[model samples]
Target: GGWPDAVTGSKKNALRRAIQYVETIIQTDISSVDNIRKDPVKVRDLMLSLARNTATVATVKTIRDDMVRGDADNALSAPTIYGYLNALERMFVVEDLPAWSPSLRSKTTIRTSPKRHFVDPSIATAVMRLTPGRLLKDFLFFGFLFESLCIRDLRIYADGNDGQVFHYRDANGLEADAVVVLNDGRWGAVEVKLGTKEIEEAAIHLRKLKERINTEKMMEPSFLLILTAGTYAYRREDGVLVVPLACLKD
Candidate 1:
């Protein structure tokens, strides 16, 4: 029963079994729900707070007040909050978007400060103990939340396709919150705003990006999108389109 060298006897079986076990653990443990639920409330709060300003820290007293609505002693410590958030991220429940630099010659450096977003916006509101009534009146807070949601949705969309999501800012301070780059290197610039009122800022930044990197070889996005709270999506004369946040996922 002499076998050829390529048909090694039990060695192949042992290697196959080991690989199966490793695959199971990698796919299951990395994003297990059990791991993320250890301190759901604390994790939620950290993600929500970071969504607004990543570098900002909320003290134990503040977190306690925001989450528990009682004495500061009940609040989670800052270190505890950070730990919970990091764990959730490891479990794929929260995603952090780092600042981007377009090119080396652009003079724009990547900012160390990152923007935090949750896999779901409801988790953020829940952690903040915010209700529908509170969100209705708190326009600024809701706006930020909506922007986060749009960013998340756009990211998902871009991921399924061959595109990248990035934020753009220049040395002169012109900035766009989100830039959608297609496979062919063509790009679409986007700005997220919370209001329906008239503001030309988004259009201004879109034009600045277009002007800075003018190229006829690559096609630009047909329209620059301004994701906002407006009820309907419409195009303005400046070539920027104002689209409601709802349109992003639609």
Candidate 2:
């Protein structure tokens, strides 16, 4: 099985085994030893909610609603939810893609809400109880999950280069899935698409984003890339490199 098709029950079960270990460690070590007063059920609910929303921008308010909607008892306050999210970050279980506040050509206000992602996509599938068959039938949702997977890999590689991963979205509604910025300030923008048919549109969006960046305030991007799930990888005429996720090394 390939990427999407590999998301089967057995695969999820294997991933769940790791989730069990992390939960046990948190319950026994971090939460207990630190005497954190948060509710365990609320923490579980928050993790599940974040898993269900793998790659999308999520605010504390939205996540709290997700929790309460799933279980009315989970009406946790925003501060409580933030505490839980912070704990997960400390445990290396989750991360937020901070918004990029770059100087731009237009007066587009950057949306500050960070996109939520688990360290690994399989954790999301395990928590959400998603299988390959279900994901195949629901490409719209699976695309988000796939982007989470890509971001996970990007983070790993970016760290090796002393770079950090950030997301871009403005008030005008334009966006980039991930932006890699190195310590020296050189950067690249990326858009992730799970389908080949969306390649051209994604490329156009990257070009437009590049145009908006104020070059006087920042170095020009080292490259613009569109990551996809398609089989072929090549550079478009516009100089944007399209790479299949399967071929990504970092």
Candidate 3:
């Protein structure tokens, strides 16, 4: 069912509508989920944690450390956070991007921490109360949220192909934003770039990651994609695909 109508009616102001919609969601939905005491405050803070660290590798220690650095008094213990995380997982509120591990040409220590993300990126924006104007003022954070959104879409698309989306980063900081590996073991790499200017660097990184993979032990990547916010989608001469985000729906 399309969600039952919210009380945001007749609100011509988009920001007001958005805020009321999220509030309505929390009061109406979070209260109904099973397996947890109904503490909206804890759930709210849990969401705040995901918002602050979205698209980054956030382990329990990572979240606890980040929180402690911000406000020691407000920091949730690791056990508390784990309990909330489990509840959110059951409710599909958070779906982390697991790390991709492949045999490498070098002995680079792969960072196995899962990248933190919400089922929908807008949850971060909503809980953070960030409008598009506010997001525009902090473009770097905007990019992080953009990556979260891209990852969300990639997960949806990968679902049809029996593929799982993973992220990759090694000790040396080499990384890919999304790695779609199918059940049969074929895989593809993707980098989410919000601008055309970054496509060149993203493409270079994708190629570097492919090189790091020990292809002899695994199938060569079926594709290398640079997903961006550009207006057009095309193939680069170097065999990398530069696809606009809009093309995904098409």
Candidate 4:
């Protein structure tokens, strides 16, 4: 069951009620936020896109075209879409994972695009009308939702540690799913993998990201971690800590 189950009181009616609830929240937020007009349709489309695609400038363009597809009058300019996104941020319905850049040995340019996510991953499940069985059957999308959950948890953990969470990607195509950096200059890189089978690949990416950093100007990473869907949490021989989502609690 998704968050809609909370209001619907039964899984049978949950998805319909949940979608209604999401729409209600969007409309309420938009009206309260001033002058955007009631564009829950727009934001709802956005939430759908956020769940299904990476939130990039290109995705935003897709959204613009999508709106215009239905009716040219419905077309929202990039600034308007961005404005609604900003309001969503204020309402805590959506958040973005900013990109991180450390001084590198080589001159590979960094990609500064922020990845968009819903504050509660459950909102995504609700909007998409996905149940546990549905998610299990679609492993690819499961990975994205699982990554969002990891990011949400890491943001909470980072807040307590006086740190912030970011994602990293460079022109050379190197990337890390999450980078936890503290105010005092210590930082760690993390990868979110839904299956233990993917842990090794994630670990390799984290290490590669570390090796790219110019250690003289930037400190070496404090740790490398991979959030996984395993039973027990343990440190691998290669130094990456494999943590099951269940173990990430106070």
Better of 1 and 4 by TM-score: 4
Error of 1 at 236 (Å): 2.1
| 118 Cα displacement, candidate 3 (Å) | 0.5
lDDT of each: 0.62, 0.82, 0.82, 0.80
Q: Which sections of candidate 3 miss by over 4 Å?
A: 1-32, 68-74
Candidate 1 residues 36-101, lDDT tens each?
A: 434444444444555444212234345445655454565777676666656667666667665655
Where is the poorest 10-residue window by lDDT in model 4?
Answer: 50-59
lDDT of 2 by residue, 147-241 (tens): 98889889878999899999999888899999999999999999999988898899999999999999999999999999988888889899999
lDDT by residue for model 3 (1-250), tens: 0012433444235445556655754565655666345456656666777789999987888777765666778777889888778767777778999999999989999989899988877677878888777889998898898888889888989998898999999999899999999999899999999878898999999999999999889999999999887888999999999998779888
Q: Model 4, range 90-178, lDDT digits (tens) per residue? A: 87878888999888999899999888788877778877778778889998888888888888889989999999999998888888888
All models, RMSD in angstroms? 13.8, 3.6, 3.4, 3.0
Candidate closer to the true structure by TM-score (higher is better), 1 or 2: 2
Task: Score candidate 1 by TM-score against the native.
Answer: 0.65
Colliding pairs, model 2: none
Clashes of each: 0, 0, 0, 0
Score residue 146 of candidate 1 by CA lDDT: 77
Q: Arrange candidates by lDDT, highest first: which order? A: 3, 2, 4, 1
